[model samples]
Target: MMTLALQRLQNTFGYDSFRPPQDQVIEALLAGRDALVLMPTGGGKSLCYQLPALVRDGVGVVVSPLIALMEDQVRALSLLGIRAAFLNSTLDTESAWQVEGALRKGELDLLYIAPERLLQPRTLELLHHCRIALFAIDEAHCVSQWGHDFRPEYLKLSALHEQFPAVPRIALTATADARTRQEIIHRLGLEQAEVFVRGFDRPNIRYRITQKQNARSQLKRFLETEHPNDAGIVYCLSRRKVEETAQWLSDQGWTALPYHAGLSAEVRQAHQHRFLTEEGVVVVATIAFGMGIDKPNVRFVAHLDLPKSVEAYYQETGRAGRDGEPADAWMVYGLQDVIFLRQMLEGSDAGPEQKRIERQRLEAMLGLCEITTCRRQSLLAYFGESEHPPCGNCDTCLDPVETWDGTEAARKALSAVYRTGQRFGVSYVIDVLLGKTTEKVTANGHDRLSTFGIGTDLDLKAWRSLFRQLVARGLLEVDTEGYGALRLSAACRPLLKGEVCLELRQDKRQSGGRRRQVSTDQRLTLPQRELWEALRGLRRELAEQQDVPPYVIFHDATLLEMVQRQPGSLGQLAQVSGVGKSKLERYGDAFLEVLQAHRGDAADL
Candidate 1:
């Protein structure tokens, strides 16, 4: 039976071996044991359950979180010649009935539906009549109230355990901390399942966090430097910002699009389609845009604002480099982001305990940004692991920041906040400290104070960095109710009294964008380049005809393999990593013809 599973892996998925721990997971499920898989995104979580469903006797039922994710998965699986279908609001009653009928008749290998739809009485009754091989719950962290993407409907998923007690179940998620992990296990009733805690580090992604000086120009510089002519995602904090930034990027000659909850369904779908199908399109969006995105070629993920926690930041940035290629997770944020997030947390309807936990998480995230050590080390430590050394990929390791003793500057800034009545915002306080003759400072008569003009040694950008560091370190607090006024926290008392010293990173001047030193296109010979483009052109044409994303036809990795190998026939092409048997039969000849044409042209030369 295990040999049969291996054969299925090669024949159906076109891979000769399993990624680490995948075979163990498949073995566990095949042996009638449940599993709790904590693999990262793009870690082959789907194969753990999908392979078992194929080798086992009945249909595998997957409880997915989003309609778009489910649809994308089904389309991708279908391209591999698997009989997969999804049941959700996207399907009409007639189409829904057809999928259900296929399930009852044992004509489907896998069936995906939303958790809300699965918990309905009719759906449960229908499933009870069919032979269910197993239950797979994706995005299992959604069951935890503490998780960033928690969905209330996920709470009802334990019903699968109660009703289908005989069927093996597997719960999987890409992001979950200690608390979120336990909550997932408790809520999903997976106490008996074997826990797989894969490491949380994404070493391929180069983490870069910069203090915002000019956000629009900073983002423009980053896009131009690291990700030119590549697909990426730029996350804003608001819908209006998403729209404005998308338009601005488009005006700057990038293929940019906007996505958020504010757009109509049709418009959102169209934009998402273009993002998926078209290469080099950058999607400027809020956090809502990424949960359903299965595009694997996103070269970078840029955050225009601070995420609420390390988990949120990790999950959003994990969307990049899904193909295990080099990618970037770049962000530009400032003091106001900290205040805005804190204000939102305080004003939310969550209970005191929840709020406290969230506050702790936010502090941890801030600490990650401010740490002088390796960013990967701090991030992994936050998730309760510490096996890694300094990763040379992050900004801290690439170009280490310089630190200066800011003891006197800290006291001056703190005193400025106090002398100004602890009611002014950062800009106003900085102006008074810098001895600016602005009307606000002159009207308030702050120029006459002894603390005024006391800290002219640092420039405006340096002052801003000091304020942001002070806020992040808990030496200062934002008066959310007073419209972001600066308030000195008790933590600053020691610093103000010279009892403590603050060592802060020296603010570096923002430089022009640097050109990328390496390019993927440089790997190919002239002949191979011609063949690569021809293969890509064929894939794009087929995607347009089939009305599916080009990746659903074949991923770039698979095409790259084809170009390098120059397979002359279907048998050789079938040996490629992502070329399953069905796809080989359907489109292999067309691609081979293109390859042949390219070969002929090169020979004539």
Candidate 2:
């Protein structure tokens, strides 16, 4: 059975083997054992249950949350010559009935359905009659109340195990903390299930968090300088922001589209389809768009606003660099973002205990943002894992930041805040420091403060950094509601009176020369460039042909690596970092042919 599954994986999935934990999970499922699979976003979590579904004696039932995901998965499975169908709200009565007919006739090998649909009395009756080999739950973290994208309907899915106690169940998610993991096991009644936890280290994605200042321009610079003509997602916090950013990016000559909950269903689907099918298109969206999006060549994931928690941040950033090539997880945040997020939590009707737990989660996220250590290490540690010596790929690891004694500056800033009655925003405080005599400053009579203009030695940007660091360090608190006035925290008292010294890491700008620019002259030349384009064309064609993401064939970095190495044979091609045995066997000859043609031209020269 295992050998047949492996053969099917090679011949059908176009890969010779399973990713790290996939085989183990598949074996457990095939043995009629329940399992919990925790893998990173780019990891092959789908194959664990997918292969088992194909190999099992009866039809496999997959419960997914999103409609788009259901469609994409069913389409992908069907393209592989597997009989698969989905029953979702998008299907009309007749279409859904047709799927039911298929299910009854045992014509479908895999069936995808939404959680709500699966829990319906009629659907449950139908499922009880059918011979279900295994029940698979994707995005299983949504079952946890502590998770950001919690769905109350998922709580009903436990009935599946209740009804068919003998059928094996497998749950999978890309981002789940320890709390969520425990919750999934308890809620799904899978306490005895075999659990597989993969490493959370996304070494290929360069993690970075910049203080939000002129975010649009920063994003523009990042796209123009680092990832010109590359595909990416620019995540915003609001529908308006998504539209505005998409329009701005389009005006700047990028193939950009807006996607959010507010758009019509047709428009949203169109935009998402365009983003997936078209290359070099940027999708400006809220958190609604990322789950189950299998686009593999996304070069970057940029956050224009801070996410609600580290889990959401990790999952969203995980969307990039899925093909194990070099990608970036760039985020711009500020003091206001913290306040905005807290305000959202406060505005929720959830219980006080739930609110308290959420606050702690947000605080933990803030700690991640503020930590001076390696960003990747800090992130992994949050998920109850650790990386030694830190990943040398993130911004913090690539450029070691410097710290200076900000004791005096903190004292001055605190004194100014105290003198101004601790009721002003950052801009007002800055005006007081610069002695600008702005209307608001004068109207509030902050100009008359004794500590006014004491920070003239530092520029406006420096003062802003000091303020942001103070907030990040918990020396100051921004009121969640209202205009976000800065208030002194308990930690500020000691620093204000000089009883304790405070140190702040010099901002990324002050550290200088860390951001690398791709030089035009060092770029690929002549036939190499031509070959690179041809390889990319082939990748797109193969991606469409296979109905998988393009990067799954080969990443741009791998292509460039191939162009540079010009590997002459399959063995030489397998030496490339991303090229495993399966990929080498499948694509090695085509690439070698391209390289050989180029080599002939080089010899002629």
- Predicted structure with the largest TM-score when compared to the true one: 1
Give residue 289's lDDT in candidate 1 (0 to 100).
80
Q: Please count the clashing residue pairs in each candidate, in the order shown.
A: 0, 0
lDDT of 2 by residue, 1-605 (tens): 77877876765675657877788888899889999999998788888888888888889998988887677667656655678999989999999999999898888889998899999899999987788879999999889887877889989888988899999999999999888899999999998899999998887788988778888888888887788888899999989999999999999999999999899988998788777766888999999988878877788999999888999999999998777767889988887787778678877888998888887788878877777779988899889887456787777777777788988888888888878888878888888888888888888887788877888988988898888778767788777567778888897787766688887877765222245533322487886787787777887888777666566577666788888888887777777756655566667787788778878878888
Write down the worst ten-residue block by lDDT for model 1: 512-521
Q: Please write out the lDDT profile of model 1 over residues 1-605, one tens digit for every residue.
A: 67888888998888899987899999999999999999877888989999999999999999888786677788889888889999999899999989988998999999999988999999999999999989999888889897788899999888989999999999998889988889988999999999987888887788988888899999888887777799999999899999999999999999999999899877887888898888899999898888746788899999999999999999999999888777889988889899899888888899999999998999999998888889999998988888789998888888888999999999999999999999889999999989998988999999998889998999888899999999999899888584889999998998888787899988676775543424455778878887888889999999999888888888888988988888888888888998888888888899889988887898899
Q: Hey, what RMSD does candidate 2 come out at?
A: 4.0
Distance (Å) between predicted and true CA of 348, model 2? 3.3
Segments of candidate 1 deviating more than 4 angstroms: 442-445, 515-517
Task: Estimate TM-scores for all models.
Answer: 0.97, 0.88
